[model samples]
Target: MKELYFRAMDAIHNACLFVAGAFLVIIVLIIPYGVFTRYVLNSAASWPEPLAILLMIVISFLSAVVCYREYLHIGVGVLPAFLHKPAKSFLGWILEMLMVATNLFMFIWGIKLCQTTWHQAIPEFPIITVGLAYLPIPIGGGLTVLFVIERFLTQKFFSEPEPETISQLTTE
Candidate 1:
């Protein structure tokens, strides 16, 4: 089960990285093209603005999944450090539960939002529907929830150590 979970996570991580890399490359190329066209050619790249926005959305969602998978999200550290082990564990559980709830909420709402926008096409990119554009939210949120659950299960059943803190990692 753990292996399966890790495999799935690895696949998702690689896929997201690839998508993010492509999106970034597109953005980089488009910006230079837009600049050159406007300055030298005296005309704008017709698709650059909309395409850049779309790429921004994709990059944000993919990077968010990467961050979640890596356990790099921002959080308060003082409370965890000051608490006893049991207290810290309990607090961590509560935090994870809250995160699960938030992810579930985003997943449900994101799907609904996408469904409602399914028929609507983006103004500049008419080839794709808004549903497709917005689909990443639910997908990324679902992945995040999965990773969180995996972490919870591993800690609960396997006694994995809590993630290290900055203070713990640095020597005085």
Candidate 2:
């Protein structure tokens, strides 16, 4: 059952990586193109600016979920470093609970925030509603909740794997 959940969440992790990478590529290409058009062509294109902003928001939020899962998110470790194994484990649990609370806050309010802006259409792009751009908040928050649950069950952060574990995993 745990393996099944890990497999599922691994798929989500990969999908997030792909989406964030794609958005980054698009941003890199479009921003330069936008600059080129503005300066060389003497035509300021509005599409690229807003489009980049939208992609950035998606990338940022989605990438945040990935970061949290990987334990890439910034945290305080100095105190934990000094603690014994039991104390460290307790601190880890406390921090994990706090993260779940924060994720839940984002998840609940994010839906309301998204809905409130649903009617407002982006002036630059009529086809896409403003609400659509805000979707990453809830998405990321929900994913975080799942990851926290996984951590609880596994008794691990699933963050950085130790070198020995990595070697063992590869061998197995």
Candidate 3:
């Protein structure tokens, strides 16, 4: 069961990375197009800026999931550095529980937010609901919840779960 969960998490992490990267590429490509049309052609495009903003929201949320999974999210090192091994391990567990709690709040509230705004549509995108733009919040939060579960599972079965970068560094 744990192995299956770990495998699924690995796939989910990769998919999030790909989606975030694709959205970033789209933002990069379209911003210049918006600029060109505004400055060179003397007519500003209405859709590009709003679209880019929506894509950026998606990218930010999705990138956050990837960062959390990779252990690349920001952390205060000073306190942890002063602790002994066991204390540090306990602190790490405490921090992860906090992550779970925070993400749970995000997921619950995000759903309520989306439902509340579901009736509204963006002016530039009449077909897309305002809620759709905010969908990433819940999705990212839910995925992080799953990643946290994976981490807990991994820790139970394995000795420890090291960040990929650290493992690579130690190998070299």
Candidate 4:
């Protein structure tokens, strides 16, 4: 089970990296094209600005999921640091639960928003509906929620007991 979880995490991490790399490629190509069209041809590509914005949004959200899975989200941890070990663990559990609930809420709301915009087309990209543009919100949020739940369960129940000191655990 632990191996399976690690495999799943690796898969998610790889997928996120791929998405980010693609976004970078798209931006690199689009910017040059946009610049050439504007400076040389005295015309701009109609799609570049909006497309770049969409790509940025997707990349940011995808990166956020990776961060969440790694417990890399920024927080002021002064309170947690001051607490005793048992209390700190309890607080961590509660914090994880709250994060899970919040992500779930975002997932549900994002899906509803996408559904509501399903029939509405973009002004410039008429073939692509607003729903498609906004679809990443729900999808990314869902992935984040899944990763958080997996981490919560593993930490709260499945993980091995912690050692009294970091040095003790690390020593050969």
lDDT of each: 0.79, 0.83, 0.82, 0.76
Candidate 3 structure lDDT: 0.82
Q: After superposing candidate 4, which stretches have Cα over 4 Å from the reference?
A: 156-172
The TM-score of candidate 1 is 0.86
Task: Give me the displacement of residue 107 in model 4, in angstroms.
Answer: 0.9
How much does each candidate deviate from the true structure in C-alpha RMSD? 5.0, 4.3, 4.0, 6.5
Model 3 clashing residue pairs (backbone) = none
> Which lDDT value does model 2 have at 5?
96
Sort by TM-score, best first: 2, 3, 1, 4
Q: TM-score each candidate.
A: 0.86, 0.88, 0.87, 0.85
List, residue by residue over 1-172, the lDDT tens digit for candidate 4.
8778768876877788688768978998998898899899998888888888888989888878866655545755788768888887888788777877887888899899999999999987899889989888887878887777677656642222244311221244
lDDT of 3 by residue, 121-166 (tens): 9999999999888899899999999988887765521132355522
Give the best candidate by TM-score.
2
- In model 1, the clashing pairs are none
Candidate no. 2 TM-score: 0.88
- Report the lDDT tens digits of candidate 1 across residue range 1-172: 8889878877877788788888989999898898899899998778897888888998898888776666556667777778888888888899888889998988999999999999998888899899989988898889888878777866642132345411132244
The regions of model 2 sitting more than 4 angstroms off are 157-172
Q: Which stretches of candidate 1 lie over 4 Å from their true place?
A: 156-172
Evaluated against the true structure, the overall lDDT of model 2 is 0.83
Error of 1 at 99 (Å): 0.9
TM-score of 4: 0.85
